[model samples]
Target: MKGIILTSHGTYASGLYQTVKMIAGDFPNIKIVEFHEGDNLENFDQKLIEAYNDLTYKDIVVITDLAGGTPFNRSVMSLADKGNVAFLSGANFAMVYQALSSEIEDLSEFVADVLEKGKSSITKFDMEEDDEESLEDGI
Candidate 1:
């Protein structure tokens, strides 16, 4: 079976991680690691490496918080010529869910589809506030 690594900006908040875990529930063997905690890039990198080494099987996917940031960049560093690993930043629970539950056996196809889905999932939501709309109501 494939393994999953859910990493964020830093070490994940326990509550948020649990929520993601709850939503991602059902994978027989998926692992998660958070990378950013109080700007501790060193710890994040180490934990990410450890998680990668431990959970990797025939296929492994790493979900990062952002594409060019320390978490993603450092995780990419672990790839020194290794190709069995797949990395995804700009991640969300939906993408991880898809990766965890995919039915395809071919790693390439699975990774391809998952990456497409992940990239497609990012959207331009309107964060700019309107004078009339409340933040709660997306005004």
Candidate 2:
């Protein structure tokens, strides 16, 4: 089956790690991992490669915090030589939760679904806003 890994700049506190969990809660199929030190642009690739190997998925999606950062750039580059994984940078709770909730398919389709859900889940207005005002608030 497919799986997900959420990578962030490692924290000494597990409290920080617990903050970004997949919305569906923890399951074997979807898990999160962290890389603490030596996670900067200079050595992200090596660190990511190590983490990737430790994961249990054949088909995997890695979600990182920011694009152009060490983690994101390294993940993208690693994907160029590998054929079984999808790497998405600039990850948020929305994206990670979306990925964790679904079943596996083609990696490309999976990536698109993640992006779509992440984009759609963002409501410009508050959930408690008046319905009448929301309609004219410009979609």
Q: What's the TM-score of every candidate structure?
A: 0.68, 0.68
Q: Which lDDT values do the candidates have, in the order given? A: 0.68, 0.64
Question: Against the true structure, candidate 2 has what lDDT?
Answer: 0.64
Off by over 4 Å in 2: 10-23, 30-44, 126-139
Tens digit of lDDT per residue, candidate 1, span 35-91? 544766677667767776777477787777788876678778865346778877767
Look at candidate 1 and give me any clashing residue pairs. 9-36, 10-35, 10-36, 11-36, 133-139
Cα lDDT tens digits for candidate 2, 1-139: 4676566656411232354442245556654545566545545566556666766776888787776755566677765476778777766656666777777567788889898887777767665765776577652
For candidate 1, the lDDT comes to 0.68
Q: After superposition, how far is residue 130 of candidate 1 from its true place, in Å?
A: 22
RMSD of 2: 5.6
For every candidate in turn, the CA RMSD to the true structure comes to: 5.6, 5.6
